[model samples]
Target: MKSHIAALLLATSAVFPALAQTLAVKTSAPERYVVKKGDTLWDISSLYLNSPWKWPALWQWNPQINNPHLIYPGDVLSLHYDSEGNPRLSLAKGVRRLSPQVRVVSDKNQAIPTLPLAVMEPFMRFEQAMGESDFDQLPMVLGSNFNYKMNIEGHLLYVKGDLPRGGNYGIYRKGDAYRDPDNGAILAYESILVGTGRVVRTGNIEAGKPSTVKIESVRREVKPSDVLMPISSGQSYSANFKMTQPVQAISGNIIASSNKLREFSTMAVVVIDLGRKDDLHEGNVLAIHRQSPTVIEKESGPSYIEDASSLDKVITQVSEWFGEENDEDSVVWHMPKEQVGELMLFKVYDNISYAMVTKTRQPVRVGDSVSSR
Candidate 1:
């Protein structure tokens, strides 16, 4: 019995030290820091903790008196140790700018955002997903005013279809279909927003009357082939962003990105296969793990080769020497996927979510899988 107790104590000591290592505070961490404008959650968290994503663990939340996630400029954060000997951070009340008329300002406006709003701007509120049939049903740009051969911003347009009076529409072109890499099943169709316009006059196709619209903005030249979708308004972005892990384990692949670049780094927009059905919500931080591009290991199924172009070049050279074309058979050692970066889910759909690459150790690519582990 004494031997068993001794072994148990040894195990307990080992486990606690590992836990402490994970929740380790950086040596350079500040004891107390004043929150300032233009500060991000990662920035402030990194000032006191080694892993910024583990910030909630360090936060000493007071459910009754404070909203731990909403910290504004001028707030004070102080480091303290809990009774259990784990490090914790406590927040002090902060102030915000008031209206000249003494009106109560919104807490979100004063609260520091989770990330730079500029990094998430285009992907958060602007992106829209639609079915292929819905894309087909949208009204097409009929022609431009004054019979101009090309259409640009601030030009008038004629559209033939049902349109609501005073509705704003985005002129779009169909983009790539996001498909699950595991099974070639399409998850969602991407709608690329190129231009926008406001309805000046509603139209009736049967009545032979076309709707009049004034183009307000254009990313690409407005064309007749583009489809019109209503500019979605309301609750697009959240200033009170909080980082939380998903309720359960999530495994999905990186299907697409907003910039269309093959290789991207921090602040790039990425789309994942997991979504509302997977119980993922906004501000959920996930690890982006991909197999190292330099190493490809033998596996039962196909290997996940990220940054394939570079990997292919390496394999091609090896093949030339060995006289074999297959890259998989050339490599025999196993390499587990390593965490290259982290992303925070900002927007979620029925079967997909939009995330910003918040941190990176290597350039991330489209085929890399993500985990909520």
Candidate 2:
């Protein structure tokens, strides 16, 4: 019994020393870290942690860092120490220290970075700034006695003399026509028609005399006996007002021919009436139309929705060409070797040849009749 007790006491003394040594090592463990300039928490975390993304975990441990963005120069980092003096990350503020600035150097020569051409290709292809030479030259019908009316505010106007009213009238605010009393042949229309105005109030004034009229906002000119009517109101009329500018028209068939061929696709390409003579230039858009395609939806099982199918090819691109005046067989400039889908002529040639597509649910095609929609 005495020997056993003595052995037990010796064992206890040995275990106590080992445990005390571990406690002393833990108490004296150092976890101080210095912060370096240009060094981010991310870099530091990446150096210490297995994953750089684990920086957020370190940030959460540090209550001083309210946000990732809060980290700045001179911030210290602290890690906890185990009994074995091993470094362990912790949120405790007392464990970390601030250090000196860290430096990073590049080994390779740095070259100025430039954007690749492919990156800018789309912008270079942008057709927004294209010229409209042909459209400026095309002959456009001004408000004639046949097509348009003029109105001042909301009132209509009537012209005096034997002139015909209610036709396409160039709504000028000031100028008028003088009739020869002897022969009554239509006299000269005024050259200095000041402004384009609509005739709102239409009534008969004495021949060769000025009539009471609510002309369009300003004073211009009115052809005596000119067709005077109120301008149509609303968006369509507004669009028409803008359409007073001349545009090109597509002529001939939009099909593939060996002689006049340009580009060809499963679709068609039509010839534009305006060309170099008409001042038509490259990158002009022409609208084409065909019959509207039929759409049908298919049926699947109870839980599934079926897909819808459509018939007919759509208009795609427009190419330009020039033809000899007397020689119908001559070819000027064909864009594609064969005709493909027709293009909408949003652009114009120098001859004032230009147009826009109707862009309707029904597809437009060659010979379908295209006007400024």
Candidate 3:
């Protein structure tokens, strides 16, 4: 538990210098674009560059934009090349378009996000990955104010054990447990957040009394024995996070995704086994690779060897890719892995991390390999 919290404090790596040098503008890119309210960095980059994951490096090319993700809605952006003919985006900060008949100004603190916030805000705001024991000990909702089976908003909830008086908690239910695809090890138990409640009446644990709480907000229907987790005062649902590139080679498996979907496409958030322990940090881009298939080919000898590094990340199966079996005349051949998509790390844990799929040529799945792009 302590280690997971510590892993959240990750360090950013230096800019991807090599990736910047190859930056080229799309032929159909706009000559000038005004940042809009719903605009995201990836959305703008996709219009200008072939690879949207190269958005950070494009910002690094411009000195006018001090912070890559700080462009506001009113800002004016111009697509122009530097003296070297390399692509660069010039920034005009807070440029409010005016009509000759009227002039007005407004103050806004919102900045363009690195990625679409709507897709990931829920996870950033309330979701967390936890071990089995972590979920077992939290207090639960024993019943409602009138012992009603349906728990709804603006109703009083009876919770087991004594909670901190006047404290806010998020009501939750146990979701499915995510297992490591390779070894089938239980990775984390997902506690599905449903609503928010506050403890209004305290109870005595020594006397086996349950506390009373009032539901302030509700997203899903709550029920008896639903878990309650304390809400952190400093809980951040921020989107303006730094993006980086890992300095060293790294690889891991995509362990989970939303709704336990087997396959997800671009803009989907996923959980990977690589984390701060692997020197990964927010903004680091990675390439998603589909598993290479094994083939039966007429070769000199058997072509099967175990890779120790990716032992628990990649699942290996004993099967023939082609119809022919492995005999004296034929040997097994493993095809090279193929790149299908790209992702960026947004949050890191001790042995797991949450990443958003930035771009995908093909749908990504659990057990797909993620490595330094």
- Which candidate comes out best when scored by TM-score? 3
Taken over the whole model, the C-alpha lDDT of each candidate is 0.77, 0.32, 0.75
* lDDT for residue 347 in candidate 1, whole number 0-100: 84
List runs of model 3 lying over 4 Å from the truth: 1-17, 60-68, 93-107, 143-150, 217-221, 232-235, 298-325
- What does the lDDT come to for candidate 2? 0.32
Runs of candidate 1 exceeding 4 Å displacement: 1-22, 62-66, 93-108, 146-150, 232-236, 293-331
Ranking by TM-score: 3, 1, 2
Tell me which of candidates 1 and 3 scores higher on TM-score: 3
Query: What TM-score do all the candidates reach, one by one?
Result: 0.76, 0.18, 0.79
lDDT for position 214 in model 3: 94
- Where is model 3 poorest over a 10-residue stretch in terms of lDDT? 5-14
lDDT of 1 at 251: 91
lDDT by residue for model 2 over 1-373, one digit each (tens)?
Answer: 4454346435433633343233221333235444444443334544564322223223323444442223344455566556756444534454334337644232122211111222222222221111223223321213333334533333434444232333223332222232223354323222222223433333333444333333444343333443222333321200100111114443432321112334333222233334456433433333344433322222331111122211101111111223223123221222222222333333333322223322233433433433222
